[model samples]
Target: MDQAITMNKTSFGTATTGKLGMWLFIVMDGLTFGAILIGGLGLRIGAESWPAAGSVLNVPLTAFNTFLLICSSFTMVMALNSIVRGDQKGLVKYLILTIAGGVLFLCVQVWEYSHFIIGSEHLESILKGAGFTGSQFLPTTGIYGSTFYATTMFHGLHVLSGVIYLSIILSMAFKEKFGPDNYDRVEIAGLFWHFIDLVWILVFTVIYLI
Candidate 1:
């Protein structure tokens, strides 16, 4: 009698290895961000008084930056859809637009950091005029600064990493590596990009708005 042979599958549920790996990474990364934000909130609650985020940060400008990120997320989805539909040209265009949006967001964030944290001459004068000492708003002076910079800078680094990731994907895309049969790479990249955007929303609401 011949024995029946069985082949072992190497995927989780319906997801392939790469897709399952990306899902695992996103879950772990989400938890990391959640812990940081929750700890920051805990610090804020424990403190007698926390520096008002709106008073020191440019709310309008950051709000606009948030809009740009949201638009980028849409463009990313369009890019993924384009590739899936066999429109390589559309995919490239939308990917470029997404990269542009990410770059613009980083530029605005750099400007905000420079104006408020690094080059604080103007902010100091404004704080003095407002009857509060300059150091009060400085990141080095309190737990508020510590938590704020820690969380924001960490998110910024993730954004920077995402941009670099997208850039590499764009290069491969331009070389025509992605198509209907091989679009899973693009989808994985999109998953990471979307997670970055989602984390920023949480960060904005928790750190800036509240």
Candidate 2:
């Protein structure tokens, strides 16, 4: 019994130092996101002239982006499962898909920001012709604009970082650095990716739908 307790299962799908550290970091980061989101909610709740949902914001575009992010989470899970089954090619394939999802999400988000901040003539014309009202929102626009960009920009940084992290894991995967006996690093990276996706769900609900 003592010997069993002393055994370190680092290579047999057990939590290692890196995994523990990532979980700790995730907890702290989650708290930080919570504080920012709560602060934004407070401001929004107190604002008497808060803009209605879909007024200035393009809800349809953002909803699509949200769906893309959620799909990325699924791909990340698939990547982990593939590696656990000792399928290197499957791991690489899913990781590439997951990374593509993150990249596309960022691109769409940047386009959305441009529409809100710099004002897109083509998009505005289309919306105006369709009888929809569109307004430009910037950090300097007002409290709503400030909080909106702050929350999203913060979350965007996480997505960008997650993409980079996954890219490194992909590189390692190409070198056959992970197998059924050892894939803790990939699992650690997946935890971070999943956390980012979950946070975006909250951000979408609060900042977009609400």
TM-score of each: 0.88, 0.87
lDDT of 1 by residue, 1-210 (tens): 011111112222466688889999999999999999999999989988776667666788989999999999999999999986778999999999999999999999887776665546777765655445663455674677788789988999998999999999999999999876567788889999999999999999998899
- Candidate lDDT values, in order: 0.83, 0.87
lDDT of 2 by residue, 1-210 (tens): 333323424345556789889999999999999999999999978977677777667789989999999999999999999987789999999999999999999999998887776766665664465344454456876787799899999999999999999999999999999887667788999999999999999999888888
> Number of clashing residue pairs in every model?
0, 0
Model 1 vs. true fold: TM: 0.88
Q: Output the number of the TM-score-best candidate.
A: 1
Question: What residue runs in model 1 are displaced by over 4 Å at the alpha carbon?
Answer: 1-13, 120-122, 125-132, 135-138
Q: What lDDT is reached at residue 154 by model 2? A: 95
Which residue pairs overlap in candidate 1's backbone?
Answer: none
Model 2 lDDT, full chain set: 0.87
